[model samples]
Target: MSLFKLDNVIQNYAWGSKDSINQLFGIVNPNHEPQAEIWMGAHPNGCSKLGTTGEPLSEVIDQNKLDVLGGYTAARFGGLPFLFKVLAAETPLSIQVHPNKRKSELGFERENAEGTPLNASNRNYKDPNHKPELVYALTFYKAMNGFRPIEHIVALFEEANITTLNIELNVLKAIGDSDALKAFFSAIMSLEGERKEAALAELYAAHARPAKTVMGREALQYSKEFKQHYNDDIGLFAPLMLNTVELAPGEAMFLHAETPHAYVQGTGLEIMANSDNVLRAGLTPKYIDVPELIDNTIFEPIKPEDIRLNPVLKEGKMSYPIPVDDFGFDILSATDESKAQYLRSAEILFCVEGVATISSEGQSITLKPGESVFVSNNSSVYQYQGNGVLARAYN
Candidate 1:
């Protein structure tokens, strides 16, 4: 493989902050401060900065200027379907969902039939693909994953004395499974006037003090945002009302298609299968296609507390987890006494910490903090030498 540097994009979302400095050591400190996303993938939206010839990434990749990645990624993903990013969410992200490819094609076509612009805000379909994401937390990450079990939600609604939400909850209880949950979500999204207003009132009445102090405050903040957008969204009460999961550094959660989810807060390195089709189910100001979301959602009640991971090893210079083809990343830590291990894969390794040197065959490169390198599948066995942390990505 030739020597070509990745072009990284820096994004400053609301939920971002720095610990000691900004983008120096990848040491992200969150206090509701500005954060940055270092994108090193081939998505048109944002691409990493190239090392040579100060130019946008797309130009280099387009002209086959980067001899290393020219033919590699394109052949694998059939045109880089995945967008690699590191998000520092100091504030809770708007609750949203992605549609599967099937749903996207159908929805895009349906809209075309109705004369909506292909890039219209109301256009929910971006492409024909399902996005399954796996986010491994580098720092402590908190997010709401999956739906709250219908029965559990029903019980919670009753406990809070939420008459309006409870009425819908009861209806959901009668239906029992995820499909019923989908129906319930649809009803909430579509109902207007008196019924919607009544539902909102009940949700507000049922709002509970979040046991997690920080998140509780955030829930209140989003509740206000929800009111501003939907006016009477009963789902506003949903955040404080559902289960929340806090992942310690190194843990991860996988969300398959139609699994209702939301990232409440925290910062982390996120990876997903190559796709961007989302079908939101509220918690956002984005387009909410209630009927379409209902049709595509799998909806069985899922709780955030249930997220888990299977840790493989952590004693040596590195740790490797069970690999699933979409993408795999492992945390690499080194000590003075640690010995470098050989690595060779159709992958990209990123150094997020102390200095380290990666050598393969007879070629080698030293990666400073926040720098990364791409290793071709044809590359020889490689080794890491230094004291630091590294994350490797591959399909």
Candidate 2:
């Protein structure tokens, strides 16, 4: 099979942040502090073209008869199974939940029957597909990734002296308690003016005070920002509020469908199953589907640390600390010319610094800083010679 090189496109998404003064250093950064997207795969919403000539990747592969990228992806994933994006959160994203396969299928049909456009911002069922996502930190990335276990949040609420949120606390006490959390979310999301405003005032005050736990500190920090973006969004009081994660450079996290989450701040490399079905609940002016988010989301409290991936190892020739089936990322830093371990799958190498040459099957490509290349599966035994850092990804 011929190697199908990737055409990396630098896209500026709107969700990016201005306060992130550090993540923008040295890259071809957006002056408007726009969210940056480095789309490496093909998903029609945005697919990287072959070159500046504007030929779509789907068309290129269709004409070439190349076995490097499967035809299924060319049809379904729009030419690539993975879509890599660099998400830099300028402001808080909406509190949202994705629909699982069954739910998405049903919802898509229901919405279609109701005559909702596929492109409408409020349309939660864009497709009947489940999106499982993974984020690798380019810098320190912070987010609320999942449902926090109720007890932890209850404890946090107590430590912060915000006793008024007890309506949710009592709900969790019931047996088969999922509905209680759902009810709490509905109450908050559906609530209006004065009553909700008073509740937010108390919650905001508690989040301001210092508490002993890590969750406590995170709660206070994020609550201030959440309030800044959404003054009285009742969803701010959900149990998911208690869990906030911050990932350092080189770390990663995975989020499956129906995992209610919000990207809080910082820059990172994100890849997901190719779909965009987000049902939002706050912090932004984007569409909010209160009923959908309430029904689809899970309300348990989560510890920020649980989503973090521990470094596996850095031994021998490769540092293969990060792992995923869709793609595996390896950090390579060579002090001298060295050969990468041979593998069965197709791979791509991105040079981080200095100069490096990848050669296999008598074909070679020279890579410099910010340059990457797709390696044929038949060209697995390549020698990389230089002094620099690199990331190698393959299926």
Candidate 3:
């Protein structure tokens, strides 16, 4: 098979940006609702379609898994292992983490046995696969990822004069990183009613004061934003406990399983394992599974530099290296003076900027900004040439 155009699925979540995805895709928003994500994959929940035909891409792949997903991938993952998405976040997302494969399988089975509906809003696990993701910033992106160093978090609490949390802070200081994190997190998530509100009010007032450090300032800003959206929810205090990271366009970060994270704002290209399972802790109206989140979360401190995936630049492509065998991600840029590079895989390409013509042996397709195409492995080798940036996802 040659290259097939894809009709992507757009998800309009409440926290999505109003203009980013629409502007990128050149679509006029009639309702002006938030356009959160454009999903391009075979996931049953939000599968992409073959352009014009309206046939689900998942069905097409299942009919010819060997040709579309390749033999090894089809045998191992049973389908496409990765789900590609364009995420535009105007408001902060929930504080959430994903389980590992084993935990996911177990949780999924348990939920199934309990007769929990698959579409239940309170469902914790949606699939029995681990979701490891990477986000490539399309604009200035801000997120809170992983845990901050214990000493730094302690100092932040001290500086902010959060006396109500003194007991939890003391416990954190007394124990090791993991136990301290669990204890501190448990204490925060356990706060109820008036006590939670009172604590949040105090934290909010403290955050209003000018912060001395960069992280502190960012945390305060995030806290204010979270408060505006969620009122006095305890999740507003997450910024103070997690590492705040800001990524410029082209920079990327990898999120492994059990690493708690929340995307604060901005648009990005995200790719993850083909799973919808999300273990949310707070910062949203969704179900909060405190024990599950705490049990699965990795409690180690993560530096911004440590989580960053520096791209390896080739002639015309920049590959973001990850440890997972499920998928690979790359940014392919072509110019008038560029050479046509060969690609060998069942690949999906989305043009984020400029116009580009991608050609296989005797077939070719032109992709404009926000347009995407699926290239089957059956196409021996294809090359693209134009002046634009394209994101490629493949196994």
Off by over 4 Å in 1: 1-3, 15-33, 55-76, 105-115, 208-234, 240-242, 303-306, 314-324, 335-346
Task: Put down candidate 2 lDDT per residue, 31-97, tens digits, no spaces.
Answer: 6556456666556767756543566665654564234454433344333455566566767777668
| Per-residue lDDT of model 3, residues 52-88, tens digit only | 6998988888788887777788788888889999999
* Candidate 3, residue 34: how far the Cα is off, in Å: 1.0
Q: What CA RMSD would you report for each candidate?
A: 4.6, 3.7, 1.6
The CA lDDT at 78 in model 2 is 37
Q: How well does candidate 2 score on lDDT at residue 246?
A: 82
Q: TM-score each candidate.
A: 0.80, 0.82, 0.96
- For each candidate in the order shown, give its overall lDDT on alpha carbons: 0.62, 0.64, 0.86
Candidates by lDDT, descending order = 3, 2, 1
Q: Is candidate 1 or candidate 2 better by TM-score?
A: 2
Error of 1 at 291 (Å): 1.1
Stretches of candidate 2 off by over 4 Å are 1-7, 17-25, 29-35, 52-54, 64-66, 70-78, 161-164, 173-179, 207-214, 238-242, 300-305, 314-328, 341-348, 352-355, 376-385
Give stretches of model 3 more than 4 Å off: 337-344
Q: Using alpha carbons, what is the TM-score of model 2?
A: 0.82
- Model 1 scores a C-alpha lDDT of 0.62
